[model samples]
Every structure is written in C-alpha cells, then in structure tokens.
Target: MSHFTQLRTKITELEHLVAALADVGYATVETHDEARPLRGYQGDRRRQRAHVIVRRQHVGAASNDLGFERQEDGTFRAWISEYDVRELGAGWLGRVEARYAYHATRATLARQGFSVAREETDRDGTVRLVLTRQATGF
Candidate 1:
C-alpha cells in the first residue's frame, strides 16, 4: 500500500519549482513531460506519479520518493509519505515554499525589467529582495 499523501501548494510554474528544489539542496530532481511513477520505501514503484520528482535515494534509506504532481488547475501539489515527513521534519515543505516564492518573485521581476539591487536572508530564513528598474526615458 502506498503511504503517500497529497498536499496542496500554490506553485504554478514548473521552471520555478525546479529551481526552488535546487535552491533547497535537491539538485538531482527529475522532470518529465509526463507523470512518472514514484518509488516506495522498499524500492518498489507505486501507482503515485508526478511531473517533478526527487528519487527515494536522495530522500533517505527508508524514505519514499518526494514528488510534485501538476494539478488540473495549473498548480502543483506535493506527494510525500508520512514516514518521510517525520524524518524530514514538518517544516520541510515550508522551506521549499519559501524558496519557491523567492525564485518565482525574481523571475517575475526580471520579466518586468526589474533587477535585484540588494538581497538579504535573516537568521530565520526570511529573504528580503530590493529590486530596481531602469528608466525607459529621462
């Protein structure tokens, strides 16, 4: 039986999601055009699938694959096992969310011709970004 449970998130962009995972130290995340099966704790493939996956090997010896499945609403939801949640801590997803927000904001700003003039991270893992845009005409 699969122990994975789906958790809703506000993530909508794939590129930003991948970059966010990388920022959180998951550099080997796999992305597929189609959903792929996730590996269980016993190394067996479960029916659960996702577009973005962090393999079981990367999670832990007894942990299942961590995944983000794209929903019909254009957002992505996380699929994580209960055991893995306990091992990875309850705040793990929060960290990923913060990083996702950071990347997404930066990308949006860049598209609007805004550049990061200053960036700071506090001891509590809060990120502060100061953006500046050039004047089109003076």
Candidate 2:
C-alpha cells in the first residue's frame, strides 16, 4: 500500500522553497492557499493536504505528485510516497534539503553584500562554502 510520509524541513518562504526546488531541477506547483489532496498509486485521494506539489514528470505514465505541507512554526514538511522516493534515488530528501540550504545560504550572503570566495563539495556531497564580505571605501 502506497502512502504519503511527512518529512520535516526548515523551509519557510514559499519563494525560496520554490526556487530551491527549481535550483535542484524539480518541477513544483505552489498551492499554499488552496490545499490539494495527495493521491495514491490507485488514484485515490488521501487525507493529507499539500501546500506545494512536487511533480515527477517521468514517473511511469501517470505522473506522481509529492505534497509539501506548512507547519505552524513556519517550517515545511513533505509528504511523498515511498515508491517515488526510491525511484527518485536514495537520500532524495537529504539531497533536496542540502540544495535548498545551499541556495538559501547563497541568497542570504548576497543580501548581506557577501560573495562566495570558495566552494568545495566533498566526496560525500557535503558542501563547504567560503563567503567574503565586500569592502566599502570611506
């Protein structure tokens, strides 16, 4: 039986979340205002409501949608089918979270007048970034 599993995330801004998903090559549909029912493998609507929908265009003939719900504390949680998770690849959520963090961090730094000085990706896909604040002459 396929079911949606909620995964916790620290994403608050809908725009950032959407941009982060896109940064990692995900097709997303924002539905924060109108919560949509998540469907199962048999095309049955589940009780879970999604603020944002992550659509897998190539998941078999029927595209599967992953729902992301907003928490009371302004965070977000994702509801995804276990089958689709495996199909996307191992540690799919972890990868998405990491990419989201990367984009969010970069945006924050840019807003603070900081530029990326150096970036390194470890063998285990851990990102290390060096940010340098721009100097202003008096």
lDDT of each: 0.91, 0.76
| Every model's TM-score | 0.95, 0.79
Candidate 1 lDDT over 1-138, as tens digits, reads: 448989999999999888988988788999998999998988898888999999988878888999999999999989999998889899888889888999988888999999999999999988888889999986
lDDT of 2 by residue, 1-138 (tens): 675677888888777777767766675465668677877666777898888876545244454577788888989888888787777776777777877787888888899999989999999988888888878999
Global Cα lDDT for candidate 2: 0.76
Best by lDDT: 1
Error of 1 at 82 (Å): 0.5
